[model samples]
Target: MNRRIGILISGRGSNMMALVERADGYDVALVASDKPDAPGLAWAKSRGIATFALSPKGIGKAGYEAQIDAALREAGVEIIALAGYMRLLSDDFVARWRGRIVNIHPSLLPRYKGLDTHARAIAAGDAVAGCSVHVVTEELDGGAVLGQAEVPIEPGDTPEILAARVLAAEHALYPRVLKEFVANERPNPA
Candidate 1:
């Protein structure tokens, strides 16, 4: 059986779109966001996928994630994919869903753990910059990497330019990685 996947996003969810375009071994059972006006929810709805959106402000992080947890459970989601979900999940959330949640980071892991990854790469004069797919752990961006795709950083390339390139890499890399991940995780059913 295909994995029942739940995708979480906060913005346009371009990566989520990429995953949807190639959802073969997985079912996108739910598309959810913390921002009620998030564009991705509309896009998901257009694709006939279930969606949930709610405001997190003043709800507290744990409370907000509890709501998300409820949605995921209701949808029978077997896997959680973070496309552009900006909020940090509580430690309890990560632990409950350990090894079942994954995220795509704009930069290679163990470096640029936080935001401004593109600018950080360029400012450091790094010759190569890329993206990584990793297990989501309680420690921010501290998960073990599952896959990576690299692109050379051209001289004087602005963060915007680099970001665009990295995003393209993300679009291509995430779906393939997720497919393989799900397959590897399938049970023997012995």
Candidate 2:
């Protein structure tokens, strides 16, 4: 049987959309968002996928994640994919999911760990920039990279332009990596 997956997104969730489109043998059990109005939640709902949308607003991180945990568990989610999820998960939450959580980062990770990756790369005058798919750990974007897709930096390219290119790469790279990840991450069936 295919694993039941839950996707967490904060914004438009292009990567989540990519996963939904290519879910050949997997189940999208749920798509949850920290922002109640995240456009992606509606898209998931339209596809008949169960969704949970809430705002972290005044709630502390622990409280917010507790709600998320309940939702994912209630749905019997087997894997958690973070796609454009802006909030930072607490260490305890990260530990609980350890190898079961995967995230996609805009930059090639370990290089641009925080926000504004495209602009950071452009400011540093890097010739190439890309995205990374990795396991989610306690540290931000510090997990082992499973795959990367490089986009050449064109001359006079602004962050917006570079971001567009990188986003395209992410849409493609994330799905491919996620498929393989699920295939290999299983325990041996006896």
Return the top candidate by lDDT. Answer: 1
lDDT per residue (tens digit) for residues 162-189 in model 1: 9999999999999999998888875321
**Clash pairs (backbone) in predicted model 2:** none
Error of 2 at 37 (Å): 0.7
User: Cα lDDT of model 1 overall?
Assistant: 0.92
Clashes by residue pair, model 1: none
TM-score of each: 0.96, 0.96
Candidate 2 error regions (>4 Å): 187-190
Model 2: lDDT of residue 81:
92
Candidate 1: stretches off by over 4 Å: 186-190
**Which consecutive 10 residues in model 2 have the weakest lDDT in total?**
181-190
Quote the positional error of residue 171 for candidate 1 in Å: 0.2
lDDT of 2 by residue, 1-190 (tens): 7878899999988999999998855789999999999999989999999999878789878888999999998998878999999988999988777788999999987899989999999999999999999999988898999999999999999999999999999999988898888887873221
